[model samples]
Each structure stands twice: as C-alpha cells, then as structure tokens.
Target: MKYVMVFFFLVLSILSCRKNKKDLINNKIIYNELIREAKQFYRLNDYSKAADKYEKAFKLIGGINNTKDGYNAARSFVLAGDNEKSFNCLFELTKSELNYDSYDYIISDTIFKPLHRSTLWNNLISKIKDNKEKNEKNYDKLLVALFDTIFNEDQKYRKSIDSIKNKFGMYSPQLKKHWETIHRRDSINWKKVKMILDEYGWLGKDKIGKQGNNTLFLVLQHADIDSQIKYLPMMKNAVRKGNAKPTHLALLEDRVSIKLKNKQIYGSQLMSKPDGSYYVLPIINPENVDRRRAEIGLNNMADYLSNWNMTWSVSQHLKMIDSIERKKNDIDFK
Candidate 1:
C-alpha cells in the first residue's frame, strides 16, 4: 500500500527517461487502471489476485525490477503463501536498482518479517546492505539524519488528530490543543529545514535519499505563505531536474494558489471550516482537472479525495464550488 501511494510520481520520472513516447499516453492509462484494480483487490484481501495485477502493471512500466512497488508485490506474494515468487520479485529488485532508501523500505515493511527465517534471507539482506552502502557512500550522513528527524516529527502530532477528536469531540479544547501542538512542531521543523536550504540550496536524492529530500517539501508546504512562496521555485527546479516528485510540486502549487485566493489547478487543496465540514477549493476547469492531474502522474481526483471520505462527482464538485463562491469569507484557507 505504501508503494502504491509512492508509485504515482516515480512513474512520471521513469516515463520521461524512457526513449519511446510512442503510445505513451495509452500505456499510462492502462497502467493506472491496472493499478486501481490491483488496489481494489488488495483492499478485499485477495493477495494472490492483487499480486498478479500488480505485476502486470509493473511490467507495463518496465517491471518491478526498476520500481519501489517491487517490495509491495513481494509483500503480497508472501501474504499469498508464495515465498518463491516473493524471493524472485525481491531478487529482481536488488539487482542494480535499489538504493539505501529502498533498502529501508524493504526491511521496514513488517509483512516481510517471515522472510527472515528463510536460509536465502541472509543472502538478500547482504545484497541490500551492499546496495545501501554503495549508494549512500557519498551522502551527507548528518543531513540525512536531520531530515529523518524532521520527517518523523512532522507527523507526530497529526497522527493524534483522530484519537484526540474521538476522546474529546471536534473543536474541543483538547483537539484544539492538539492542533496547537502540531503547529509548534511544524514551526520547529520549518526552522531546521529553512536553515538546511540556506546552507545547501536544495539537496538532491544523491545527497539525502528520496524521503529525506521530501522533508524539504513537507516542511515548506506546512510553512507560512512567506516560506512557501520563497521555496516554490526551488522546488519547481528540483522537479525539473528529476530530484523531486511532480505530484509533490502539484500539491504545493495548489496550496500556494489557495493561499493566494486563486483557483487550484490540480484539485489537491481543500479547506475545512470551523464546524469541521470540508469543501474542495475552487479548481480551474474542474471538469478536466483529472486530466491535468494525470498529466503529472497523480491518481484521478476521485481517488485522492477518498481519504477524506469525500466523493468527486460532477454534481458534488459543482455544489462545492458554488458554496465557495457564495460564502467567500467563511472558508479559512480559500
């Protein structure tokens, strides 16, 4: 599931690096559909079916050998009681493809815990450790540790939102206190991230690893507008250089747009009002926004909003847009 979440933006970079643009659009559509169905099967706990569909999608994008989703497929295979398939999938992954960051992704997923008991597991672990050592040999170890801290702390308070709400109710002082704590964490993270950027400009994957580099965007996106506005171009440049994810940039772009009271292009930004009801921010050409989203390798708008328990239908979108227009001052973010 984590790989499915991360695969979208990474696919864009892979597609761009490929030589053939011939029928690329058609292939992307097919790949996305397969991934969607694979996720559905995963949700239903049909691990065998999920693994099959996931492999098909991976094949379309040049196989799990080159993508992080290889780990996801392997995890599914293990869950489906096919240890051989999982080993083969991981063999492909460890072959000149994974980096230090990927090694962590492979080990940290608890589904792979059973593999540790196998005789072959030691061989795989050795190969993965070698990959990590080789790839991160030139990396700034200190910066990597710093970003790791920032990334972990960024979610520390946000993870408590649901529990706080459930225990004390929405808008209660306890929930409000939780948000205040979140803001404090965000501020501390922003200060560290800003200092890193000032000293190093923007760190690339080679220097900080993928998730470490993402700490820059995560902190900046949560920053005040002055901070977001300042680093926006730096992030765009990072995306252009294949150092950052397109989906990340699209999200930050929408966040900045909403902060400026302009329409969001990708429909990634939404607003929550005082009563806890949410509204989608006004999107430019809400009809074709999904196409725009796909252009940069985002899932369709419907899937992205599902986490909020919101549906994205033509009628529902129009109603939200209409309400945003009617109550201009009511929405805090818009």
Candidate 2:
C-alpha cells in the first residue's frame, strides 16, 4: 500500500512538469507566430488581420510591456481602423525606450491621415520630445544627397516636375503649374520650401495636390498645427462663401474645435463644395500628433465629405510655382 502511494506521487509530479513545459512552449510559439503573421498581413495591407494577430500575440506575451511587439501592434491597429487600440499601444510604447523614429513614424506616416488636427492628438504631442539635433543631422545628410544628384540635370528635374504637375491636377485642379517651379528652385531646397510653406500656412498642399484619390491624405498626414490653423480658416471661408457644404464643413469644424482647440462656434454658413478632396487639406497638417485619433476622426468624416471638390488651396497653388526650380541628377525616387 505504501509503494502504491509513492508511485501515485511520482506520476503527479511528472504530469505537473509536463504541463509547465507545454505552457512555456506554447507561449513561445504564440510570440513567434504573432510576429510572423503580423508581418505577412502588413505586407498585404490587410491591417485588420494584422491587428488581430498582434493583439492575440500581445495577450500571450503578457501585454503591452513588450516594446517591439507593442510598437508593431499599435501600427497594425492604426491600419486596422482600431484607433483606440492603436492609441493604447502607442501609449504603451512611449512608456518604453522606443526612439524618436517611432514618434517620427507616427507623425510622418500617411496611415494616420484623418486625425492630424485633433485636440486629443495635440494632447499626446508631449510624448514625442524634440530630437532637433538628430533630425537636423539626418535632414542635412539627406538634403545634401538630394542636391548632388539633382544639380547637373535640369531636364530630368523638369520632367519630374511636369509629372508632379500633371498628377497634381488630377487630384486638385486648382494647383497652378508655376507653383512647383518656385518650390524646387534650389534642387536641394525642399526643406526650406517646406518650412516656408509651414510659416506661410501653405504646407502639405503641394504633395496633397499631386497625389491621386488613394493618396490624397498622404500630404495631410505630415501637416503640422500651423498648417491646420491656416487650412481651417480657408475651409471656413469656403463655407461662408457658399462654396462648400455646411454639414461637411461643420463636421470638420467640430473636430477641429473639439480635438484641436476645443473652441466652439455656431454658424449657419457652411462650405459649398464636397468634403472628399477638401478634407485632405486639414488632414495633412504637420502638427497632427496622434495617428489613432486622427484616423478615427478622418474615417468618421468620410461619410460626410464624399462630394467635396478635389481642388488645391491658394497656398497649394503657390507650391506648384515653387516646384519648377529643381535640378535633377541621380536620386532614386524610391
């Protein structure tokens, strides 16, 4: 009878060890699978699937504490139309040692096209501290390289400019050809031109005007606060002039007031144009701080902004004039 009891104890110990081992192996598999699957979905632009896989992985890995996984998860969430989850994931990422590149990706990536001017987004701006030294160094290096390639071949640059002009008109008929000439005069002066646009409230218009329907928001994705401030006024003016729709303009106004400055005003005057193309102006504001918040707001605006004119703003017109001065050499478009 004593031997029988000892045998039973031994069996229980073995079973317990086996269970632990299986759990460990399974947890490892979940991590590996999630990472692999997330990459696959991302490559295909299947953000929804990628987000789900990432979420599952996060759970199995024990949560947002995993910085690399968290970063990818948040990015996937942005693509998946799950702004809340993306925001949470980004917030978690901020708590870790993620670098300026992470924050830069949030700011510059076109995926967050809709949320550039939100107050909630602005509130989160504190998360990305300035990396001026690094940014300047990087920018200088890239700019130098751009100039060396574009300086010797004026004709090559002219063709690129024409392509930009032709494409710009497809999305924004309002863009003037001369503006691109002015924007690219120095061959390597895009940075200065961008800064000038920002200072003058004409930022993001060039790129936005140049893209097609699918990439209209790409410019807005990089817009800053100053640019949004400049754009909202224009949108308001369009509304008051009866050039745009009240409903759509009102929605943008509401988002700006609530998510940007939280200032509210009621007016019967609205824009006469459709919101589809016009919405891109505000979305491109460089000061746009949070991808998730901006995306949520943009998606919501889509229903109302459908018919808006795909035209460029006055500032955008100016940028076209600026783009003509570029000197092309050998910089790969990629």
Candidate 3:
C-alpha cells in the first residue's frame, strides 16, 4: 500500500509538470494566432469576434507591450461596445514591462468613449487627471481626456462616479436635487446642469434670482451642502466666469441623445430648500427603459409632454437644454 501511494504521487507530479509545459507552448502558438487574427478582424469590422479573440489571446499570453496587435485588440473591444473589456486590455498592456504609446489610438479614435462610463476607466483617468491637477499638463490635454469619457457615456451618474467627483464638492445640493428628481420620476435635467456647472462653477446673481412664482438659481444652488457652506466665507469667488458654455453645449447635446432617442420631454420646474431659497431646475428626459419600449403607451403617462407635442421636437428630447435655456432667458428678463 505504501509503495502504491508513492508511485501515485510520482505520476501526479510528472503529469503536472508536463501540463505546465504544454500550456506554455500552447500560449505561444495562440498568441501568434491572436496577433494575426486581431488585425484581420479589425479590418473586416468584425469587432465582436475580434474582441473575443483578443480576450482569449490575452488570457493565454498575458499582456504584450508596444505592439499593434494588443493595441488593435483594445480598439476592437471599444468598437464592439465593450469599453470595460477594452479598458482591461489597455490596462494590462500599460502595466507590461515593455513601454508603448497606449494613447496613440485614443488621440485619433472615438472608440474609447463608451468606456467613460466604467469605474475602472475612471480610476485610470484620475491618474491622468492627477498629473493635470498638479499643473504637469495643459487643460486641453486633461479636459479632452476627461470630457471624452464623460461625453461618450452620456454622463449618467449611474454610469460613472467621475462626474460626481468632478462637481460634487462644488455643487452638492444641485447634485442631490438632480438625483432626487430622477427617483421621483420628476423632470430630470442633470445633463444641462452639468454643462452650466462645467462652464461656470456657480451661477452668478445675473443668472439667477427670486421671482414671483418661480425663483431662479444657477449651478451654484445645486452645490453640495458641505461645499455651499464651506465656501460661504469666500462666496464672491464661488462663481466661475467664462464662455465655456459653448463647449458644455456640445457635450450636453450628446448627453441628451439618451433622452431624445426615446422621444421624451418635460416642463418648467422648481426646487426649494429649508432656508426658503428656491431654485428652478432644468427639464428631465425619459429613462432608457422607457425609450426602448416598443409600445408607445406601455409606460406612457398622460401628464407627460412628449416630443411630438412640444414647441420644438429637439426640446422635447432635451430637458437639460430646455431648463438651462429657460434660466438663460430668465437672466435676460432680470
């Protein structure tokens, strides 16, 4: 019995070593195949298939550095609507001992946009943003990288936390209010709110005020309670002065696509705080779930003002745009 046990152990060890060797050889062959196929798949627009092969290749060979094969594999994942996977590939590649330009494709490509929604993507982005925050890079370099992700993911809070990190410290109340509206199924105009805040940190007095029935407030009003309270001593410096609205506007349009694609709309709205301070919030768009319903009345509400019935079809789809425009006009009225 003792002899049999010893023989069994010896055979098992031998098998294990052989298996490891076979795996290593198999990996080499698969890695070469991946390189060949990834390029072909990408050129043929078979992104999904290419992505699958890339993932398998990565599993077998681990990460390869400074090679078009790995880079193109990441690109295929992005084109395939799997940004998380693309990000993983790039992340692994970036960590390789070999140095390569991962940013090469990002500069000329739009494929990386979808990954802006991923948490992993945001974490990596912060590393990049950190460099900029320290003044090691220019605004164009930093902002473009930041904006690309947020814009592609439609800047939905559910998609990524970066947007929250970007503005929450400054606009807590507004951010909370926007979140509440989403919960209550009230009009949601966060996309527009983001634009206003991004361009002008806090809305100056000219952009907001108290009126008879409706009070006007800028992005500052939505600031987080802590920041609002914290900045009280430096109240005068809270607002940002710039014409960054145009850039925000461009991004806002893309965010609104999530709403417009479903043909949703909203009306003028206002929010109030315990301090008697009132704010007019931007419009809310429809949820992605509602947008995808094949039936019109499956979840339709009679009270809801759809795009076909609105003053402008585009307005129906963009509550954030409408709300900001309303606030803009209100500023003119004052």
Q: Whose lDDT is greatest here?
A: 1
Q: In order, what lDDT does every prediction score? A: 0.80, 0.48, 0.47
Report lDDT (Cα) of residue 103, candidate 2: 41
Candidate 1, 206-322: lDDT as tens digits: 899777888888899899998999899988898888888999999999999989989899999878887766768889889999999999999887777655656788677888778
TM per candidate comes to 0.69, 0.34, 0.30
Question: Which residue pairs clash within candidate 1?
Answer: none
Worst 10 residues of 2 by lDDT: 208-217
Looking at model 3, residue 159 earns an lDDT score of 32
Q: Write the per-residue lDDT of candidate 3 for residues 95-184, one digit (tens) a residue.
A: 425333223224335457677666876575554344334432223443344333433323234333324524563247766766664433
Candidate number achieving the greatest TM-score relative to the actual structure: 1
Report how far off residue 199 is in candidate 3 (Å).
Answer: 46
Candidate 1 vs. true structure, TM-score: 0.69
Q: Give the runs in model 2 whose Cα sits over 4 Å from its true position.
A: 1-18, 96-101, 130-334
lDDT per residue as tens, model 2, 1-334 = 9999999999999999999999989898667767677767775678899898888887886776566677777778877877888777766665535433234335654556555555556545455534322333434344333332332222233334435645565335434444455445532343433453345333121221111111112122223445445566655564566443444454455445534733322211123234322223223332231332344333222222222313334355335324522322223332
Which 10 residues in a row give candidate 1 its minimum summed lDDT?
A: 97-106
Q: Judged by lDDT against the true structure, how good is candidate 2? A: 0.48
Model 1, position 81: C-alpha lDDT score: 86
